[model samples]
Target: MPVVFVARKGLTKLDEKFEADFWAKSLDNVVEVIGNPDCPQAADGLEVGRAYQFQEEQSFSVAKKGDDFAKCMEQLADMVGYHWRMAGADGPGPFRDLFRHPGQFGTIGPVTSAKLAAEFATWDECARAIGKRSFYAWFASMRRMFEYAKTDGGVWLQYE
Candidate 1:
């Protein structure tokens, strides 16, 4: 299985009918509805027969075979504030470990847009210890993640 990332927008009572149609006519085995355990706010109020509307949904694989994953890595490196270069195959890059094991970096969950924005307001001390470039890159990546999360209305991460 490949890691997948999904972007979703929460629906309100007005979209109940559309949510129903989505669940009844569009849901598939490959797409899992993000719920309580992983997204608390999504399941804040429990009710049976209720329809939940997601305004957006996008999936991306994170394995070597996935082009999006590679693109994201390249983009992340370029967007960082640091003037760091990706390490060659023989060397460990600043984000080599993160690229190899994305799940270890963080978990998916509900988060306020402001909170997400605040996360990257400061650079990581550890990354700074590695090098100024590394620190800048780390800061940039965090900002990027926050931006994504804000647009998606939640944190999303999946790994095989």
Candidate 2:
């Protein structure tokens, strides 16, 4: 199965009682918020006010194998002004590890508004990183996600 990065929004009105009840019935299928320690402002967990319900339309499916995926990731890192070599031990570098394990879901972020804004600010850098058609496709996918996050809210990576 391909690992997909998804962004969900527009369902931010669940009260605490509803949230608890929802989780009680669907904990296994519930998605959790993930945090990037490097981003101090990143949400540590799901915030009640900003919570969103998952929707199929929000998915960005990424292939788990082949050169297409690898090259795209390389370009994505570059576009985001993120240098793989400079990534700290706990940074996005772990995303590469997803390829090694197939069919497993790995969650990556409650990527806060600050982080999303920072990434959007680097749009030009990302565009310049697109050296090939394959890279463009990946960049486009990620770009859509980032754009949505700007208004809808934070983002998270669900890899499998």
Candidate 3:
């Protein structure tokens, strides 16, 4: 089964109050993306029906961007894992644990090898169950980050 998850975007600083308003308005469609007025990638992704998260920083550094996205991935994984854990913690009856329960059908058990294998099986059953769009959006985001870097006198891998 494929499941859809939402990640909320957050913005910090801006040039002007109206800049935030314009940025927000521009990114109404995308789910979780935030950025400064100058870096409107988040907003752009959102306006185009993609998901992104906004971040406000002084410069466009590859390491910084990678670290931020790494943190975002961790957060996303934790959120999804915790959601499943909480939803399926209790049981309908004695047989609930033995069989797949309703409402929390795809949630995984403890983090052992068996549990990990089960989770991987669940994820491989359908790309969307774990999050395929997220990978696409993340790749686009990284590409955009590199594009911004290349345009700003920074090092970047050429993508042609």
Top-lDDT structure, candidate number = 2
Off by over 4 Å in 2: 17-31, 36-40, 44-57, 64-70, 77-82, 88-130
Q: Per-residue CA lDDT of candidate 2, range 3-39, in tens?
A: 4666655434243443444665653223444433334
**Could you tally the backbone clashes for each prediction?**
0, 2, 10
Model 2 residue 62 CA deviation (Å) reads 3.5
State residue 78's C-alpha deviation in candidate 1, in Å: 24
What value of lDDT does candidate 1 attain over all alpha carbons?
Answer: 0.42
Cα lDDT tens digits, model 3, 1-160, are: 2222121223222333333346656743222222323222222222222233333222212223445444434433453443322334353322122122211112111111133224333433233344656553543343333333222111112111
Which structure is stronger by TM-score: 1 or 2? Answer: 2
Error of 1 at 36 (Å): 4.8
Candidate 1 error regions (>4 Å): 1-4, 9-22, 27-52, 56-113, 124-129, 132-142
TM-score: which candidate is best?
2
| Candidate 3 ranges beyond 4 A from true positions | 1-85, 92-111, 128-160
Error of 1 at 157 (Å): 3.2
Per-residue lDDT tens digits of candidate 1, residues 1-160?
A: 4445544445233334334346556543222333433223332232323444445544533343455445445554554432223343234434432333333333333344334445445434533554546335534554555455554344346555
